[model samples]
Structures are given as structure tokens and as C-alpha cells.
Target: MKRISSFAFIFVTIVPFVGCHTSSQNVLEKKVEVKLEAKNNSNASGLVKISEYANGEIQITGTITGLSANSLHGFHFHENGDCSDNEALKAGGHFNPDKSHTHGKSIASTEYSKQHAGDLGNILSDENGEAKIDIIIKVPSLTLNDENKYSLLNRSLVVHQDKDDEKSAPAGNAGKRILCGVIKS
Candidate 1:
């Protein structure tokens, strides 16, 4: 009986790690990279890496430097992947494939009740003008494949000059675009 209990415990622990990828519906190895660009006189640059996990969650991690130093800046994924111009308008507006998208938190009552799929809120830089973001988007709103209209592939993430209130209509009036990056799979 003791041996059987120990075996069960090991099996349970190892199962998640071994069969995790097979259990998910999306591609686990699919990843996107956004190389940030500094707009105008702003001093900010970084690379944001986005990947899908086994639990249908999106994982974003990266390092940014040359922010306002200990300040909060709005960050989000924008439609279009082109960052060829200065104003960053080449990247289009916030990524909202559906008209039902709103401005709210990622975890809202319903899929369309919250905010734009691209709305990722804010990231605070340390006093050294550097910010490191490592967050797991637990919501199923973000996807890597074409099955979901909210797929983050071929998009670009733009950082604003100010903090996002997370309540304002559209994009929370997050000020000017300080940096932008194209999301490539």
C-alpha cells in the first residue's frame, strides 16, 4: 500500500510536466518577438518575447531600459506589424478584431466585456530607468493560432508615455507612443 501511494504521487507530479504540451489545444512552441523602438526624443528600447503555454495562457517576458525612471507606462499590443515609420502609426491602432472589445482588465466578466485584447496595462520602470516584465496572461483571450481572432501574431506592442488608467474608453488615454515593436512568430 505504501509503495502504491508513492508511485501515484510521482505519477501525478510528472504527468503535468510530461503531457502538458499534448494537453493544450494551441501550439506550445509558437513564439513572437517585438523589438521596441524609441519614438521622437524618448529614450526607451527593449525586446518583448511572447509565447503560448500548455494551459492556454500567454507568457510575456522582457527587459526595457531608458524609461522616465521609476514611472508607470502604458503597454499594449497593436494591430499591424510594421514599425517602419516614426510616429508608430504604421503599426495601426490597438488590436481589436471584434467590435465587442472594450477597455477593461484582462480578466473581465466576459470575453467582450473587458478591454481590448491588446490592452496589457502598465509597467513600472525602476529608478535606474529600466523595467523588466515577466507576466503570464492567464486569460484565454490571447492566442497564437488563427482559430482565435485575438491572435497576437504579426502584431506590434506599443508603450505609451504615461500610465494607463485602465478605465477610459478605447486605450485609456495612455499618452504618446514611446516605443513600438513588431510581433513576429
Candidate 2:
């Protein structure tokens, strides 16, 4: 009877742990893909691809054909992910985890806290008027999956014309919002 009681207690305790581990796995495993289209009255359309892995790093790539070869552009993640009509508004304000007003990552004051969550560096075009970019960023919403956690599902992506001031207000005078898209799983 003593041996049987010990076994029962061990099994009960182990079973709950196993269940909890599996459940946590399911919650943490998620793959998100985001596609972007840049369009406006002044320029041609552009394409961008963003992949969110389970490890919390985001990979972003973009290409713009027929644009100025030697021009610089701005990229960032907005607050919302709604890609419906007027994607600009859906993107919300810049991702301000620390509530700072810096624009691009390069110009940020604290390297980590100066720039907003959406503040990516400039996307430069080559002589062929094509811009290709690859970047890795650590985002809270893209990394966390707990129901009580905040996600970037409702956030939007924006491409700007000029370089981000990294200390400017609104949009760093980055011209206009050329392209916009929402992130999703």
C-alpha cells in the first residue's frame, strides 16, 4: 500500500507538468508573414516581405523598381496592423515602447530606447533604381504569444521618402507614407 501511494502521487504530479509543458509549446509556436505594398499619387508601387519567426527576430526585405536609384527611404512598424482602406491610419503611431520620439535606428539616442519600435533604417536604392533590404529586429508583439501579452497583429508598416530624423516629431519629415501593410499570422 505504501509503494502504491507513492507511485500515485508521483504520477499525478508528473502528469500536470507534462500537460503544462505541451500547452506552453502550443502558445509559443507561431509563424507570421507580412506583405507590403507602397503606393501613392507621387510614386510607383513597391513590394516588401517580412517574416516573423518564433524566436522573436523579424526578417524584413523590400524591393522598389522604377524609383530613383540613389534615393533613401524610411521604414517602420506602426501601431495597428489593419491593411484596409487608408492603411496609414490603421498603422497608428510609431511603436514607442519607451515613449521616445526618435525616428530611425541609426539616429536613436540610447541605441535601443531612442528609436520607436517601428523605426527601421533607411532603404537605399542601387544604380538600377532597385532597393533590397534585409534586417533583423526584436519586437515585443512579434515575440510574445501569451493571451495576456500584446502583439503586433494590428500594426502597420510604413515606407517614407526622406530619411527619418531619429529625433523629429510625427514622421521625421520623411515626405509621405509611400507604402503600408499590416502584419498577421
Candidate 3:
């Protein structure tokens, strides 16, 4: 009887945790892939993996190489999915469906705003021209369906040659779109 009671208690305590874990994984069943643009037609390239979480948060994790060392690069999502243009101008402006002037928040800032959805602040590169990126974005909503404006799918990711000044109209004074990649599920 004592053995049976102990087993019952352990089972009850662990079951809820197991269930919650499974449920969360089920919610994040969607994922997006990003392919960075090459420079000078060389072998320079990078890729990013973005995963959508249960609570509508986005998990963006990537390792980008072939970038300038000890520099700050502007990272953002663009309106169009096209990155074919040499300058990636085909991606158009930022992902500002709301038409708000609220620019990107500083990476260290915790304040929230109705700013452009594509403004993801900046990405810093190490001295070796490499960057290990791991960040989360809590957008209003994200769906795999392209019809949804909040959907990040079919969007473009851009890396600029300069650091994002963090406060500028439209695109944050970040000069030259260097790398471009389309977000696809």
C-alpha cells in the first residue's frame, strides 16, 4: 500500500509537467527559414532559423559569418519577400503595415511601441566577422498563412552595412542593405 501511494504521488506531480511540455511543443509546430545574401559573388553567406512559440513569440537563432568585424549591423524584416535585387531594394520598406513612425526600439530598451514590425534593431559582429544571434520577438501575432498581415512568412530579412542609429525615419539611417534573405515556412 505504501509503495503504491508513493508511485501515485510521483506520477501526479510529474504528469502535469510532461503534459505542459508536450503542449508547448505542439503550439510551436511552425518554423521559418532565412537565407542571407552573398557578397561580391563570393562564398560569403549565412542562414537563420526562426521558430514561432506557443504564446506568439518568435525565437530567432542564427550564426552569421562573412560580416565586418567589430561592427554593428542593422537587422530587420522587409515588406516584400523578394531579395533578388543586388541592393535588396526589391524588399521595399520596413514591415510597417500600421504606417506608424515609431522607429525601432534600442536593443537594450524594454519599452514597447507600435513601431514597424520589420524593425528588429541591430546585430553586432565579432572581430572575426562572425555573429551568433539568439533573440526573441513578441509580435502581436504570427501565422503561417500569408493572408495575415502579422504573418512573418514570405517576408524578407535584411542586414545593413552600418549600425542602426536606432532613431531615424523609416529605415534607421543604416547605410546600404548588405545581406538579404526571404523568410519561408
Candidate 4:
């Protein structure tokens, strides 16, 4: 009888705690942290955190270092996650799941159809060669759900040598990829 009462008390104490903890954790179901790898001798490295909210808003925040001081670098999402190639060619082109083949304005653009779904615009580095990223993408199509065609997971984030011109045909004339990081949940 004592053992049964002890088991019941323990179960009662832990069950509610676990339930409450899981319920609060469900707020951000899709959150991933990616570690960047340097390419093309750019010597850049960073940690990026991507969080998907319940309302379809994606928040990306991180800090990249070893970039050109006080300069702008083009940052975009690539279709492929492979970064084996030194030039980052293995990552493929920008993620344009929306069929917006044309490279239009980047994150600043309000029209989703005008730009590639992965077009994140330029990230400026400070004097210390560190670029802090804090951007919220309000696009519904770019999600973390594995079933979605436009899911960002398993994709690659590429940092370019130059700033995105925002009007170039193929990839905004961003030059060669200098850093790459695969996004995962």
C-alpha cells in the first residue's frame, strides 16, 4: 500500500509539470541553429538561429565574423544544402520556390512575386568584421515545415563577396559565395 501511494504521488507531481512545460514549448515548434562554414578563403564564420512563429513569421538572428570590415555582403538562401565545393557551387542558386525566376529587390521588397523567396538582401559588417543579423521575414511561403515545398530546412544560406545590387538577372551580381551554412531543424 505504501509503494502504491508513493508511485501515485510521484506520477501526480510529474504529470502536470510535463504537460505544462510541453504546452509552453509548443509556441515555437520550428527553431533551428546553423553553424556557418567558410568558403573561397573568406575566413568567415557565424552562428545563425532561425525561429518560426505560430503566425508564420520567421525570425533570423545571428552574428557573422571575419568579413570585410565596414562593407556589405549579399546574403541569400540557396536551394541545395551541400557546401563541399570551395566556391559554394554545390549549394546551387537562390531559393526561388515561388517561381520568381527574376532576381528583384531583396528583403526590402514587399511583393513576394518580385523577388526570390530566399533573397535576404545585404548584411553589413562593422569595423570589427562582424555582421549582426536580425531580420523577420513575413512571407508565409518560406516556412520551416518539412512538408512544404518552400521549407527553408535542409537548404543552404550563402554569403556573397559583394553586396546584392538588387536588380541583377541571375543572382543580383553578388559575386562568388564566401560562406555557406546549411539550415536544419
Candidate 5:
């Protein structure tokens, strides 16, 4: 009986490791580069990398150069990927996950519903107009394919002059739409 119990324990532990290795090997990994451009020669560029995990874990990194230091900027994914001359028009709208109204509020707001799908958080730059952002986001409703259902592909990243006020009107008075980019796969 003792021998049988020990064998069972070993098998249970070892089996999981084998299963994990096999599962890890089967997962499809993808990388994408996003080029950010300043609307009025703001001189800002950055790269965004996204990795898909099985448990809704998305790793994002945004490294920007040529920005104002010690300033708070609103960073988010816009509805459209268009980067036309008009940065405001190119960015489309904020990224609201709950289909809420347009508002530049905190990410923890309960009111101001019906928001856009790309309303992320803020981006803080360093003294030399550089900001490196690394975060893990949860996208429960996102897939790896491009079907226009809250898809990140062909989406634009917009940087605002001021912080988003989650409950305000017409972009929460987030100031000018300075930087824009199109997320590509």
C-alpha cells in the first residue's frame, strides 16, 4: 500500500510537467511593431509589442522618443488606424471596452458608461522626452485574428495633452491629439 501511494504521487506530479511542456509548445506566438507619428511635428515615435497568452495575459511595451519630460499624457488605443494629417480625425475615438459614452475618466470609473474601445491609461515621459511603458493587460474578448471585433490590428494609438477625465464630454478635455500610430501584425 505504501509503495502504491508513493508511485501515485510521483505520477501525478510528473504528468503535469509533461503536459505543461506539450501545451507550451503548441501555443502560437506572434509579434507586432507599431510606428507612432506626431501630428504637428511633435517628434515622437514608439513601438508597441503584444503577446497573446492562453489566460488572457497580454504584454504591452511602449517606448517613445521626442516628447516633453515631466508631463502626463493620455495614451490609448483609438478606434481607427488612420493617421491622417488631422490627428484628431485620425485617432477616431477612445477605446471603451464596455461600450460606454465618450469620456476621459479614470480606468476605475463606474459611471460614464458606453466608452470607446481604446481608452487606456496615461503615459508619463522622462526628462529627455522619453517614456518606456510596460504593462500586462487583460483582453477577455480579444482573439488573434482580425475580424473587427475590438481588434487591435489597424488600430491607432493616440497621446493626449492632458489626462483623461473619465466622466467629461468630447474627450474629457484631454487637450490636443499629438501622437498617433497604427498597430500592425
Candidate 6:
């Protein structure tokens, strides 16, 4: 009986410590890259990287090329990760997990609840048809953790053919989806 009790105590103590260590590993920094592909025969392709910073801030950085020179294009995250459609319509509309807010500009100044969580504003291409993406805004609703309801994993990243008016209803008057990529771990 004594030997059994000793083993039981060791198991109880060691199991909790092992569990805590495993969970801590999960809280570590996570990073994922999405490879944007051309849609509708558009010449837009790029590699976008999403990473979590020290202060729990998530950043998106990358470069897109083959865009119209000196032009602006709408960029956003969609509800689905499927980009198999030629027009990328399978990705569905902007990711609005809350389903309460209207479409609005996703900028640093915009309130978190006022804009759709997936509204990422625009991407501007330079003279060489390349747009360097470096968005480090504070989007509290957007997270990398899959357990969070507002998580961006397994979603679709889409590039529009035109600019986002930032005040439109459903979508910001952004043109057809020209490029698409799936955000994954």
C-alpha cells in the first residue's frame, strides 16, 4: 500500500508539471506565410508573412508584384480559405466573424468594432508593379491562435482589382478578386 501511494503522488505531481510545460510551448510565438496566387489571369503574386511580436502584436509584411504600376488595390481577408475558383468567389465575402459591423477602412485610427475584422484597406503598387506590404496596425480582433474565434488561420487573403472606398456596404466597392492566397500555419 505504501509503495502504491508513493507512485500515485509522483504521478500527480509530475503530470501537472508536464502539462504546464506543454501548454507553455503553445503560447510561444507563431508565424505563418501565405503565398498569393494570381486569379482571373491577373498577374498578381506575392508572399505574405504573419507573425506575432513580443507585446502580443501581430504584424503582416510582404511584397506583391505584377500589379498595375502606380495603382492602388484593395486587400482583405475572406471567410474561406478555398482559392480554387477562377475568380476566387469561393472564398466568400470579407471575414466578419462578428456579423454586426459594416465594411470600413482597417486603419490604426478606426475603432475595432466599427470595421469588419477582415478589412485590411489597400496595397499600393509602385512604378515597377510591386507593392511592399508592411501593415503593423493594432487589430485586436485579428489573432493567430486557432482557438480564438477571430483567428485568421485557414482564411483567404484576397486582392481586389480596384481601390476600397472604405465606406461601402457589403464590400468597399472593391473590384473583382484578382489574387488570392490561403493563410495557414
Best by TM-score: 4
Q: Which residue runs does candidate 4 get wrong by more than 4 Å?
A: 1-26
Deviation from native of the Cα of residue 29 in model 3, angstroms? 2.3
Model 1 Cα lDDT, one tens digit per residue, 1-185: 99999999999999888797666556465677778999866888998888887667788899999999899998888888887788788888888877677877543223545666777878999999899988677666678766457778778889989998888877778888889988776
* Model 5 worst lDDT run, 10 consecutive residues: 105-114
Q: Estimate each model's TM-score.
A: 0.79, 0.66, 0.81, 0.82, 0.73, 0.81
Candidate 3 deviant stretches above 4 angstroms:
1-26, 39-44, 106-112
Summarize candidate 6's per-residue lDDT along 1-185 as a digit string, tens digits: 99999999999999999998876552337889999999999978999998875455677899999999999999998999899989999999999998988899874457777887888898999999999989875765567876466888989999999999899878899999999999888
Our model 4 lands, by Cα RMSD against the true structure, at 7.8
The alpha-carbon lDDT assigned to residue 167 of candidate 3 equals 81
- What TM value does model 6 have? 0.81
Tens-digit lDDT track of model 2 for 1-185: 99999999999999999998876652234545556665564354566666556656556666666556788877777776665554365666776655654665542223455556667767787888678877766654544344222455656777776777665776666767767777665
lDDT by residue (tens digit), candidate 5, 75-174: 7777777887765575677765456446654432332244554656677888998889786655555544554666677777788867765556656667
Instruction: Give the local distance difference test score of model 4.
Output: 0.86
Note the Cα lDDT for every prediction shown. 0.80, 0.64, 0.77, 0.86, 0.68, 0.87
Off by over 4 Å in 1: 1-27, 106-112
TM-score sort, best first:
4, 6, 3, 1, 5, 2
| List of clashing residue pairs for candidate 1 | 102-115, 104-115
Show where candidate 2 strays beyond 4 Å.
Answer: 1-31, 83-87, 98-110, 139-150
Candidate 3 lDDT (Cα, whole model)? 0.77
